[model samples]
Target: MRNIKLTIEYDGKRYLGWQRLGDYDKTIQGKIEKVIKLMTDENTEIIGSGRTDGGTHARGQVANFKTTSEMTLEDMLAFFNRYLPQDIVVKNVEEATERFHARYNATGKQYSYYVWNAEIPSAFERAYSFYYPQQLDLARMEEACEKLIGKHDFIGFSALKKSKKSTVRTIESISIEQEGSLLHFSFVGDGFLHKMVRIIVGTLLEIGAGSMDVSAIDEIFENKVREHAGETVPAQGLFLDEVYYR
Candidate 1:
């Protein structure tokens, strides 16, 4: 068997997220698997680097699957593009080592949240960005991000019912930047919990709007309480930008 790695980009507006849910009719992983089975005429299961919630887009999402097909990587990419839905595309495909596992081997990930800070609705970016009318204090939001750039118990930032193996994760960097009416919040981290990125973005939004003080960031770390954290922002604004290995 050989491992095949694929780089994917998707518009997540009409899907049920990345995982294969028994009840859900639409998902990125499910759609990919359907196409793979059709192309190879073999039962194949694709494993992704992470599960992105419904309506959350991805620019460089990585996935891997084991297959015994004789098709070349280029053929596989072409086959997927022809069979997959228009909104989801297989950007690249390459043969990988048999031991390669997309999720397990990833060393870090980068996520970006886009905010449309304009009063008028943006027709082109409406589906991809979060619309917020408040004037943001970019400096204060940047200051609050400094507290998130280290290893800490992120229980407060995750969903309440998540029973993950550990809540402690290291964030390599967190940055807030504004370009005209668009504000972007980016994060590089070793790993993340469910809703972690959205919660972080929500917290920063509060700080930007002058609703939360920068010092409150420390409380999120110290308290380790989910309720103490900021709201979980909409998934449409979050994008899994890239995944790193090594």
Candidate 2:
């Protein structure tokens, strides 16, 4: 058995998400699986590092699958690129240890949320970035971000009602950068709960807009209540930049 790892990039606008659903729904996993089946004529199951929500893009998503094919890494990459849809691309393919598991072995991930805060919206970037007309106070947003770094209970940021696992997660770093009319908020963390990043971004946006103070971030962290956090930002703005493993 050969475990193959793939670095994938995709435009997530049309698909339901990463995971494969029923035949009625189209998904990223399903598309890859279809192309795999076509290339190797083997019934394979591909597992991703995580499930990106609908409309969320990915630049360096990692996935692995076990296959019995005799195809080489180069052949597999070429075959996938030829067969897979244009929206999704296989950036690289390599053989991995049989014990490799994409989700379980992941160490950390980095995500970025892009905001277009200019007067005129670009027709091409509208699908990938969130457009905000208001002027955001970047310094205030950075101050709020400083409070989020470190291990903390993020129950307030997640919307998963039945999430029984501990919400304590470590955030290694968070930074905000601006170039021209584009503003990017990036975060690196060990793991994240469902909708946690979006909610954090929304709350920070509120702080930058003067609708909420930086102290409110602390209160939400202390309260561990979802209602105390700001709204969940749109899914289009979030992108899974990379997944790390050792």
Top candidate, metric TM-score = 2
RMSD of 2: 1.1
Write candidate 2's Cα lDDT for 1-246 as tens digits. 889999999999998889898754479999999888898888888999999999999999999999889988999999998988899999999988999999999999999998888788878778988887778899999999999999998888898776667888999999999999888999999999998999999999889988899999999988888888888988899999999999
Best by lDDT: 2
Kindly list the per-residue Cα lDDT of model 1 for residues 101-162, writing each as its tens digit.
Answer: 99999999999999899878688878888898888888888888888889998889898566
lDDT of 1 at 91: 93
TM-score of candidate 1 to 2 decimals = 0.96
Clashing residue pairs, candidate 2?
none
RMSD of each: 1.2, 1.1
